[model samples]
Structures are given as C-alpha cells and as structure tokens.
Target: MTDTLNAKNHSIEKYLRQDRMPHIWCSGCGIGPAVSCFLRAIDRAEIDPNKIALVSGIGCTGRVAGYVKLDSFHTTHGRAIPFATGLKLAKPELKAVVFSGDGDLVAIGGNHLIHAARRNIDMTVICVNNFNYGMTGGQVGPTSPLEARTTTTPYGNFEPPFNLPYLASASGASYVARWTVLHLRELERAITEAMIKPGFSFIDVIAPCPPIYGRMNKMPLPMDSMHYYQEKTIIRHGADPKEADITLNGPILAGTFVDIERPTFQDQLNHISSKVNAQV
Candidate 1:
C-alpha cells in the first residue's frame, strides 16, 4: 500500500460525501459529533476506510451512511443489524460497523439487537441514544427514561428505559461500553476498541438531540444539551456494571462498563463445522 493510502487524515471531511454536506439532522443535533467521533475512531484504528462497511437504519443518526464516503448501506428502519450481519457473515474480511438511533435499534429492532449479541457476531454496533425519537418528532422511545416528557408522553413517561450497555453485556456481547458526547476522547477510544475487538461489540453513545428532544425539555440548543451531559455525567473508570444505571434526570453512570473475551460467533461456527465434518 502507498503511504498516502494509509495516511492518517484528521479531517473527516475528506472521507465524507460532499453532496450530502447539509445533513438532514437539525442544527445543534448530537448526530454530527457522534459521526465525527466515529470517523476519528476509524482513523485511530489505522484501518483502511475502504475496508470498512457502514450500515445504518432510518433515523436522524441513520443519515451517517449517506454522509460517510466508505462502503455504506442505508437500509430499512430497524434492520441495520440484519443487513450488517449478512454482510459480515458473507464477507468476514470486511469490518462492519453499524450506526443507528436508539429508537431504530433498541425499540423496533430490539430482538435483532439481543440476538446479535447472543450470537456474538463479529461486528460493532454504535447506537446514538438521544433518549427520545428525534427524527420522528420527539416521541417516547425505549431509551427514554422514566418520567421523561416527549410528544407521546405529555404527562411524563411512565415506562422504564433500557440501560443499553447492561442489556448488551447480559445478552452475551463480548464487549460493551457507554459514552456521551461530552467525553469525545473517551468515546473515540471506546469506538476504536469496539471496531478492533473480535466479537460482538456494542457502544451506546449518549447523544443529545437539541432541536427535538432537547427543545421539548429545557435544553433548547445542542450545546446546552452537551453542557447538560458535562454536568450530569459522572466519570467513573473501571466501574462495576451491576451498579450502572441510565439517568434521565440525574447524574448518569458513564464508563467502559464491560470487556471480556468470548469465542466469537465465527470461531464457534468453525469449531462446530470441524466436529461435524470429523463425524462424516
């Protein structure tokens, strides 16, 4: 490979689709920062952008597929995982990274998410958790905290939100981490780790949707939501996963919660194949 081919470019603009410059996401939306972090992570990993496959679903964050200049797929809503799963299984050489919103993944695609984790599929899932469904007029979602207000939850939400990292860890994901936009460096590092890890890796990014979810609440600007994350996020390193909880109104438990080595889905499949072939 030529030196230019592997050169580390800090500016993600070079890798972005210029025609999609003016993204559909609202101003002050956390999606932009999340995309930047993801790009930075790819750069940090020293992986060829050509070798990466970005898969996304229908949501504000899903616009990432249209923005990045890699092998990208803009699939149906809540089905990015199944698409990514097939891509990874077919071309196991490709690095599959899925980017989706909380509503697209944990809600409508909840079964896929858990099953993917349980299978320990070799891929990385980056979920931009803005709490409410930002693309759909700020409706209540599975990631919306208890008592949070949304378009559908005018009287405050009565349901509980899923602690995504915990759910992933419990579902057999080999690696799980949660980071907010405030921790940009940490978020990048977590993403890079997830990408290189040889098993099912899930990163739930606590993003802020200023125009929709934020506006409905007191945070009217994207920076306001970012500052809120700065103030409400308690940085606890090496924290116990069992003690972590997603906070809707208070300080949130944020950190790289889980990292364990398990037999990857591919590895287990190969083992089974060898055993079956021996019997034949």
Candidate 2:
C-alpha cells in the first residue's frame, strides 16, 4: 500500500509542492479534481512550467497557488485578477493564470473581472463555482442558484445568480467555456485551449461543495452532486451565452460558448506606441 501510494505521488509530484501534502480540502471536495485537471492540462499544453505564473485570491480554490510548484501568488481576497493583470503587463512573456472560487472572483472582485475581460488582457481565469463560500462557513455567493440554501441564506436564496458565460462573453473575453468537475476530459481540454489562446480566457468550473452547499441542498454526498451534474449537464459546443443561466436543479448548458480573436491589451498598446514613435 505504501509503495502504491508513493508511486501515485511520484506521477504528480513534479507539478505540486509535495511538502504541502495533506491539503486542507475536505474529502470529496471538487477542488482536488479541478486542480488535477489543471496540472494535466498544463502538461498537455507543453508550456514550460517555469513560464507559467498562477495567481489566486482568498478561498478554497485560492489555495491552489500554495500547492502548485510553479511560480504562484496567493494574493489578497478579491484581488487576484488585478495582481495577475499587473504580472501579465510587467512580464508579458509569462503566462499568468487566475484560479479562484466564485465568491472571490465574481462577488468581491466582479468589477476587476469585467474590466480585465473588457480590456482583453492576456491571461486565463479558472473559476470554481460551488454555489457558496465553502471555506468561510458556506455563505451565499453571487453564483448561488436562486432558492438555494446557504449559511447566510438559511431559508433559501432569492437573488439571481450570474450567468458566468454570458458575463465573460459580454465583457469581451476572447475564449469562454464552462464545465463541471465530473467532466474531467472536457475541462482539461478547455484549459489547454485557453492556455494557448491570446487574449482573455475564462473557464467556469461548476464544482461541488458537498460538506456545506450539498448538505443544505439535499445532496449530502459528493457522489450525489456528481450524479446531479451528470444528469443535468447538456453539452452544446456553440450555444448562445445568454441562455446558459443555471437554475436550481435545472439543465446546465456546458460548452465553449465563445471563441474569437481580439487584440490583447499589450498588443494594442504596442501598436499605438509604434504609431506614435513613427510619427514623432
């Protein structure tokens, strides 16, 4: 058993800070699988791990940076995007990736998300949406389905959740996609594509918060949530983003809703600078 465990560890150790083993995530937490998919995607993309910088804010998913062996930053809450933006601008050669949870990215840092997308910044954002803030006592988040129960919304949530794909598309992201943790292959493929894409890319991962969100919503087990995802997910590769809004126990449209080319912030700036210099 020890040999088997060590062998399994050896396979993934190259991408992880093995000294930080025994991560704090709960059993059956989707974050583990999501992170695994990301590592695999990076390998598949064949980019030098040293050239990739991972940035994450405060949340369960934010802990990803701490565990990753690559250059990573665990930034202040709701500030991962801005930090990543600065990193990308300062070191354009490095591939900056923002990996964080829904509440940290969409609720407290929503303005940053929209503006970053609008500017077509060169970066990839992987948002794990578990319906609530899993780390901080499971409070209701911006992506929580309407009528879903959370710690703050004990009775049930009434506010509408953000249609992440629609938001990403409307904000001018060059690449946008969504998938659940259960869809490992698809999620990894999306990540791999995003890594190679030029402008802002966003992938919304619908993960499971079984310990809190699940228990409150009649899905106490992680497998139950996975089953729910399997049953509800509808793969539509080119569906309209506006119709991808997720409702409680409703069909979830997952796919690459948007993939278009646009000049990145750096690209536009360079062009303007060259023109000004030529005129001068």
Candidate 3:
C-alpha cells in the first residue's frame, strides 16, 4: 500500500502543490477527479505551463487553484471570470482558465459570466456543477434541478435550473460543451479542445457532491452518482443547447453543443486600436 501510494504521489507531484496534500474535499467527492482530468488536459494541450493562468472563485471547485502548481488565483466569490478576463486582456499570450462551481459561476457571478460570453473573451471556463452549493452548506443554487431538495429548499427546489450549455450558446460562447466527471476521457478531450479554442469557451462538468448534495438527494455514495451518470447521460454531440435542460432524475444531455468561429473580444479590440492609430 505504501509503495502504491508513493508511486501515485510521484506520478502527479509535478502538477500539484505537494505541501497541500490531503485536500479538503470530502470522501466520495468528484472534484478531485475533475482536477486530475483537467491536469491531464493541460498536458494533452501541450501548452507551456508558464503561459497558463488559472483563476477560481469561492466553492468546492474553487479550491482547485490552491492545489495546482501553475499560476493560479483564488479570487472573490463568483469573480473568477472577470479576473481571468483581466489576466487575458493584460497579457493576451497567457491561456486563462476559470475553474469554479455552478453556484459561484451561475448564481453570484452570473452577470459577469453572461457578459464575458457576450464579449467572446478568449478564456476557458470549467464549471463544476454539483447541483447545490457544496461549499456553503448545500444551499439551492442556479443549477439545482427543479424539485430537488437542498438545505435552503427543504421542501423542494421549484425554480427551473439553467440549461448551462444553452445559456453559454445563447450568450455567444464560441465553444460550449457539457460532460460529467464520469466521462473522464471525453471531458479531458473537451477541456483540451476548449483550451486551444479561441473566444469564450465553456465546459459544464457535472460532478458529484456526495457529502451534501448527494445525501440530500438519496445518493449517499459517490459511486452511486457515478453510476447514475453512466445510466442517465446521453451523448448527443452538436445537439441544440436549449434541449439540454437537466431535470430531477432526468436523462442528462451531454456533449459539445457549439463550436464556431467569431471575432474575439481581443481581436476586435486590436483591430479598433490599429484603426485608431492609423487615423491619428
């Protein structure tokens, strides 16, 4: 067991802050695997780690920035996108990535998220949607399914959850996709693709929050949620984002919903700047 543990540690040490071992995520939490897949995507993308910047907001997923060895920023709650946007605008050479949870990205910082997409900012946003607010006592969040029970909604969540892919596509994301943590290979591939893609790229990753969200929903074990994902998820590449809404115990539509080219915010800014300089 010691040898196995040492070998595992040795393999992933390069990507992590070794001093921060034994993360705070609960047992059966899916954030760890999502982070692992992200690191693998970084490796697969083959971009210089020095040229990458990771920004995250407050949440279980936000803790990702603290563990990664790269240039990472733990910003204010729900402000990861704006922070990443600033980083990208200041140094357009850097590949900025916003890693945060659904509650942080879609609830508190939702306005920034929509505008960032509307402007077609050059960044990769990886939103880990675990249904409820895992970090803040499992309150009902923007992505919590209708009728799902949360700490704040003991009776049941009645508000319609946002179809994240649809929102991204409608807001003008150039590349949008959705996948569960169970689909590691596909999720890694999607992340790799998003990292290399220009303009606003959004990937909604459905991860399990076994401790809080899961227990409240009768899925106490992580494997149960993973199994649920395996059984309920439908791979529908290029499907209309509007049809991707997730309902309580409903079939999950997962795939790349949009991939197209458009003038990025930086590109347009540079063009306008050049024109202004020429006129002057």
Candidate 4:
C-alpha cells in the first residue's frame, strides 16, 4: 500500500503541474482516478511526455489541461475538438489528446465530435461522463441516463442518453471503449491502447459526481457511487455497440466496442498531395 501510494505521488509530481497541487474536483468525484489512470497509461504506452498536447473545453474535466505538465490548451466552451483538430493537423507528429466532460464534448460540441471521427483524424479523446452538467449545477446533460434525476429533471429525465461507444463507432471512430472509475486497470489499459492507436480513438470514462449528481440521485456518498458502478458493470469486449445503452438503474455495458485500422485524414491528404506532385 505504501509503495503504491509513493508511486502515485511520484507520478503526480512528474505528470502534473505541482503549482496546481490542489484540484477543484469535489469529494468522491472520479476525475482524480481517471487522471491517475491516464498518467499511468502514458508511461505504460512509452509515449514521450514532450510530444503530447492535451486540449480541453470549459467544464469540470476541462481543468485537466491547466494541470497537466504538457503542451495543452484550455479552449473556449465546446471548442476543444476544433482546437485539437487544428493542433493535430498543424503538428502531425504530436499526440493530440482531448480531455473534457460529456457536457462540454457531447452537448454543445457534438458536431465536432462526429465530424472529427468521420475524418478519422489521428487523435485520442477521453470523455469523462458524470451524467450531468457538473461544473455549473447538477443539471441533466446529453449523457444522463433515462429516468436519472437531476436539478433540471426533478421528476426524472425523459430523454434517452447516448450510448457513447455506439455513437463513436457509428461516427467512424477507429477505436472506441468505455470504463468506469471503479475499473482502474481496465481504464488505464484502454487509455493506453487509445493513445497508441493510429486514428480517431475515443474512451468514455464514467466517473462519479458524488456531491451534486450522486446526492441528488440518492448515491449520497462517493463510495455509494463507486459500489454502484462495480455492481452494475458488465464487461463484454468487442460487443456490438448498439446494445450498450445505459439506463438509470440498469446494467452498465462497458468495454472496447470498435478497433479497426483505416487511413487517417492526414494520411489520405498526404497521399493525394504526393499524387498531385507526381503528375505536376
């Protein structure tokens, strides 16, 4: 236990800006674990820290860019993808990683998400889904499960949530996966795989919003949310994305749903350019 703690502390000091020592995430919030898993994944993947560029939009998870010790951008609300897209295209050698909350990425930035996947850009997106707009208030969001309660959905959420993995796969993502904060090993593995994958890779990390979303939904303690995730999760690697919809109290379908090789947008562009030059 002591050695593990020491290792994590070392990783935090190495990967994050020490001046930002205390993060602003709430108690029992799962973003911390997600970040830890991410840090470990970067090392395990053998990626050079100097070659990574993390981009995030405005939200709770968006603060990651400001904290990580890497070339990062904290862009305008819902613009993380567009910003990352520009950065990736400009510096194709750098590993572009987009880290943000579901609200920032899928709600207002949904268009960018689909189009980026359609282009099969060489980028990795790590979306922390807490099922509500966590930063402002506990409001229902694009990924709030059906019947999930929140400040806005007092009675219960009527709208169905997007099956994130399914959406990414359908939008042409070259790699897709989902995992809760409770599954640290799996989460880290998925992030590592996504980081090394060549095309548009995405991972939906289901984290707890204990103070707001969880308390409102009856998971009062952070542990309560963690336990819920552990008990409800169903791992089915390579499962069909269409059958992975998440409901308020139903099983949480989690795993890698898609991973297929395809020429990236940059690769295609370079190919065409070479042909044009040859003909000219």
Candidate 5:
C-alpha cells in the first residue's frame, strides 16, 4: 500500500523496474510509447496500481504484462478477453485491462472481442495496431491497409483492413476511441477514460513498428512514422461511425467514436439479485 501511495505521489518512473532497464522491443517500436501512455493513464485515473489487473494475449503488446509491476497475466493468444471477463466477474472491484495486438485481437480473437462487448463486461481493452504482425516478422494482419507490403503479402495486400473503431463501436463497446502514438496526450486521456468506464471500453492505438513492419512498407524510420501520423492524422471529437469509411484517408479521424450508457454485466446480475432477494 505504501509503495502504491509513493508511486502516486512521485513519477511513474519510480514505479518502473529499472533492473528491466532495456526492454526487448526494437529501436523504433511504438510499444514504448504505448506503455508510457498506459502508465500516464493509470496515474490520471488516480486509481491504486495495486488494484489494477492487466490481462494480455500472445504478441509484442502482450509483453506488457511482464513490464507493469501489478497483478498481470500473460495469457494464451487471442484469449485475453475471456480470461479478463472471468477475472472481472470474480472481482468486480478490480480494474481489468486487456493489452493485445492487431493480429492477436482482430484476427484470432475476433469472436472474443465482440462477445465481451455484447456482454458489456466491465473491462478496458487497449489494442496496439501497427497494421502488421510485427512480432512474427511483419506478416499481414487484419488491420493492414490495402497495398501495404508484408512478408506474406510480398506484392501488395488486396484485402481491406478492418476499420477497428467502427467495428468496435458496432460490436457494442460502450466506449470506443482511436489514436496514434503520435497523439500521446489524447491517447493517455482515452486510456484513462476507458479504464474508468463501467462497461466494455475499447481503444485502438495506431502505433508504428519501424523496424520490421515499417521497413517493409518503406516507413523504415521512427521519425518518418511520426511525421506520417502528424500529416495524415485528424483528431476530432464525437466522430460518427458512419462517416468513418467516407473519410479514411482525409483524416485519421480519431476521437470518442462511440460512448453510450449501457447495462453492464455486473449491473444486470445485481439487478437480478435484488429482485430475487426482494421475493425471498
């Protein structure tokens, strides 16, 4: 408890394990910013880090579980949500957060994502979509845009990428937001909001993997990636899901895409309990 208190009073750097000084991520990977933003979000929430449980799936982003000095679980690939769902149900007071990758969540774990949203599970999911399977040596992922080159897509990717924010919103996520690593402040705020939200909250962080993924797509440098996001990104408030497709290239079109009050899983269960207890 004292340690958590100290972490709150002092900088998040105090909470980080200096012994784990050099992370395993590549030189220009955006995972570093993602982690930093998450820590900032945690600080902004003013919630005890001890009470937060981080659940992650197998991927580059999944490695976050080991880095954060909290109750963390590095679960199987694409199973972070189900594991988190169980954890939230067992301990409703704890803040359950899922950290996964584009391939980990949208590809293999697509079903889990939607089901969790449908249940309105009280958990926050922050997925880092670098547009390729970076951990696996830059393979084509579900979020990889058309014409993007990958290991598998040597010529050019033909299939359309899933508009993650729109998908999440339509799938019933109570809170949905999208932001690139370049927009660190907004990303931090979105993460904080998602963590505090009572229902399923999903954030698609468009990060850049300069080494493996970006190198293949001609975005080999971190600065180039950042500049790309800066020029292409359009930060808006209260964006409509319907307009997302029409303005894909015009602006990154990121903001609180969807936020609506819904009966959380715990709320429904408690309501049923109250009714039964009344009758008894």
Candidate 6:
C-alpha cells in the first residue's frame, strides 16, 4: 500500500523536470514507457544522474532531453549522434546517450549512426522505432516494415525496411538489443546493460504510434498493437542479427544480439597519443 501510494504521489517526479509536465507524447504512445524504463534503469544501476549527458535529435523522441533532469542537448534533425560523439570525446568519463526516433536517427542521420558504431564510440543510443515518422504526419520511414501502410505509403511500402539489428551488428556496435514496449522489465534491464557497457551500445525499441502509424497499419487501437507484439515477439538471445528483419506482422526478434568487448574510439585515440608522446 505504501509503495503504491508513494508511486501515486509521483515517485518518478525526481527524474523529470516538473516544469515540463504534461509531456507532449500522445496517449497510448510507447515512448512514455521507454522513457520510464530508462529512468528506472538509471536508478537500478545506481548511476550518478549528474554524470550522464543526453542528446536528442528533432523528433517525437527528441523531446526526451527537455524532460530528463540532466545535462542534455536537443540538436538538429539527424545530428544527435555527432553531438554525442563530440561530448564523449571531450568528456570520456561522462556517459553520453543519444535518444531519438527512427527517422531522426536512422533516416537522415543514418550515416552518423553507422560511422559511430564503426568507430566504437563510447556511448549509448536508444532508438524508438514506431515503423513510421509518427510525429511528422506518419509518413513511411526507413524502419517501416515491408508492405506496411503509412500516410505516404497508402497502398503499401515497397522498399525493404532497414534491418536495424543487422545494420548495427555489421557496422560494429559493441552491444545491441531490441525490445518492444510490452516487455517492460526486459527493456529496463537492456537499457541498464547498455548504459553500463563501454563502446557504442544501441537499443532498438519497437514502439506503437497508435493514432497515426498504428491506425493506418490496421492496429487502430493501442491494445491491438500490444497484442500483436505479445503474440509475434520472439526472444532469441545471441541469435544472428541478419535473420532479425521485421516484416509486416512478422516474427519480431527481441534480444541482445551483440555484446563483445572492443577498443572504443577514445581508447584508440589515447593509444596513438601515448605512442606519439613516447617518440617525443
């Protein structure tokens, strides 16, 4: 009873900038759950909130920076990764995080995403994938599954959706995982693991955009989307990322695909610096 009342009394109030209350996220939007999980992960991991620097690009998910009670940046569309890269390089001790939507991170910012992973930058990237550009009129986007309908793709999306897990794995992320908003506990744990891990860590959070993408794609109700995720999700740890492509109503692969130790960009830079100093 006490725990329930405490939570009712706004337990999560501390992590949020209350002045920004009444967030813009729509009812039934999965972004709220994803953010809640991230906050819980920080608490569970016992991370010093002050030591974290969050960066977000222009999109629905980008608003996370404004709400989080921490040092954060709301950068231009598709520039979140580069900003985070600079922050990580300048302050290697502080954990850099990039929180953005599919369109902002993997669409115009796709180049930055792959290069950061390739360099193994010490940062965490949380990508909220709602299959379409939820905020911007629900257009078909890079992550829109094949044949999925959107405002732009009224009939169906012919272009093959980017297999995010495979792309991240191939580009060389140190840690990668995918989870639906329905898997609350697993999602929280994954965020915690990603935050604690070194090198470029990426999380693909498959979420629902009920009024727009979901309604257009036949998941008119939020519960419809939730049921679909519950029924279709496949938990396969260490599975090959190549086979984790998400098609319309296909088996959704959810798990950590990559968790390997690799030299981060900072480590390489330091090594070269040390070598140059030895010759000097």
The TM-score of predicted model 5 comes to 0.92
lDDT of 4 by residue, 100-165 (tens): 999999999999999999999999999999999999999999999988899999999999888889
Best-fitting candidate, scored by TM-score? 2
TM-score of each: 0.94, 0.97, 0.97, 0.96, 0.92, 0.96
Q: Can you write out model 6's per-residue Cα lDDT over 1-280, one digit (the tens) per residue?
A: 3343343456566888877878999889999999999988888878999999999999899999999898999999999999999898788889898999999999999999999999999999999999898888999999999899999989999999999989999999999999999999999999999999999999999999999998888889999999999999999999999999999988899999999999999889989999999999
> For residue 221, what is the lDDT in candidate 6?
92
For each candidate, C-alpha RMSD in Å?
4.3, 1.2, 1.3, 1.9, 4.2, 1.9
Q: Name the candidate that leads on lDDT.
A: 2
Go through the candidates in order and give each one's C-alpha lDDT: 0.87, 0.94, 0.93, 0.93, 0.86, 0.93
Clashing pairs in 5: none
Residue-by-residue lDDT tens digits, candidate 1, 114-228 = 9999999999999999998887799999988887888999888899778787889999998888888888899999999999999999988888888787777778877887787
Clashes of each: 0, 0, 0, 0, 0, 0
Off by over 4 Å in 1: 1-10
Model 1 reaches what TM-score against the true structure? Answer: 0.94
N/CA/C clash count, model 5: 0
Q: Which tens-of-lDDT digit does each residue in 1-280 have in candidate 3?
A: 3344563645556889888988999998888888988898888999999998999999889999999999999999989999999999889999999999999999999999999999999999999999998887999999999999999999999898998999999999999999998999999999999999999999999989988998899998988899999999999999999999999888999999999998999989989999999999
lDDT, candidate 2, residue 40? 91
Model 4 residue 47 CA deviation in Å: 0.9
> RMSD in Å for candidate 6, one decimal?
1.9
For residue 223, give model 6's deviation from the true position in Å: 0.6
Better of 1 and 6 by lDDT: 6
11-47, model 5: which lDDT tens digit per residue? Answer: 6675566667678888878888988989888889998
Ten-residue region with minimum lDDT total, candidate 1: 1-10
Pairs with backbone N, CA or C atoms under 3 Å apart (clashes), candidate 4: none
